[model samples]
Target: FDVTFVNKDNLPEYVWANSWGVSTRLMGALIMSHSDDNGLVLPPHLAPIQVVIVPIYKNAEQLKQISSHIEPILLQLKEMGISVKYDDADNRRPGFKFADYELKGVPVRLVVGARDIEKGTVEIMRRDTLEKSEAPLEGIAGHVKALLEEIQTHIYRKALAHRQEMTRTVDTYDEFKKEIEKGGFILAHWDGTTETELKIKEDTKATLRCIPLDGDTTPGVCMVTGRPSKQRVIFARNY
Candidate 1:
């Protein structure tokens, strides 16, 4: 799977890489990072349905009329490069559909009912913030596009902040152990020996995740085995 696309002469001396396939364990990380008591808050880029359009009506004739009116709007949104879904399932009620879409992490939901049709507007609900607003039927495509971009950027910033807050730097074994118990990445010095690495794993259950592409070259002593060290390595109990 590691196909080299570059010329042999242009390759670097050490091309370090690791491939870890996604498994059910990734779901655990997702839930830990994004879920709350109410439900999961999905990143906008990962949501299957960017916007769910649910037309509410009492009778079949009313449902048909509402659907016909919303068809062109849906098509216009699609043409503008927005992912949209129409939920017209008869089995579930509107409340049930709302709950289901929220669980699946749809970024936005638009409810277009008989009343909304008369008012020339739609009820919009944001999954991440749970904020509801009324939007005019005409400019929904552009508004939704902007809202989705904002949600995507917000999720990335939140996740990056969590990663930064979890990272810890320790110069002593006692501090390393204490921080590792709190469950986060630990940056520490190592002697660059497989034997010491194995011993650390045997004792703390933490392994070197990466040596980092760019690190300080200042010489130091290893924290574990008291051997001469060159650079620090990031260690963690990985997912």
Candidate 2:
């Protein structure tokens, strides 16, 4: 959609303009590409704050000491070029901040408290696995950096695994209907005609997503027209 000023001649219409962009559809595709039950989880490498550090304290002195102890770790992370955030919100409790960051998809969370400082350890939480482990605070920069990389790979694999599970290959039109109803990428032979493509779309509400560059080329009859074909194209219902 576009907004434009239409020009007019002295006594008649002179020019008309039209514009179009499909970026919102791209955003919708990204949102659906990674479907997880835990909610929205962005790729770790793409997130601004890969690690969020939340300080826990009761009194002013504890807060001061915790701040001092965390300074070196934060500086070390910065030097290593890791994106990190120290959430020191005065009003909200630690639990609230934890949920907020997870919803925002922070890959790792570091919880530091008076006990952690005394014990010389910090609680490290991974967003992908939602697992927490206590690790030594000394030289924590390396641990945090490695954890970020692991989470990055983990979420990506999770998305790939989901896509693999949802993908289906069908040999006949009947089989295509059964599989496509499950809602995912369907690989099937096409007679390669625009008419059959539109007919199947009108019948099943599934459209040709793409003729995958790496699609299977084994010989088979088209699912709709039963004509000889070389490769299986991908069909699916997409927004």
Taking the candidates one at a time, how many backbone clashes does each contain?
A: 0, 0
Cα deviation of 95, candidate 2, in Å:
1.4
116-227: candidate 2 lDDT, tens digit per residue: 9999999998887889999999989999888888887877787899888988888888888888888989999998899999999999999988887776888888888888
lDDT of 1 by residue, 63-145 (tens): 99999988998898889777899999889999999998888888889999999989989999988778999999888888888
Candidate 1 lDDT trough over 10 residues, lowest sum: 12-21
Whole-model Cα lDDT per candidate?
A: 0.84, 0.85
- Candidate 1 all-Cα RMSD: 6.2
Among the numbered candidates, top TM-score falls to 2
Q: Against the correct fold, how does model 2 do in TM-score? A: 0.86
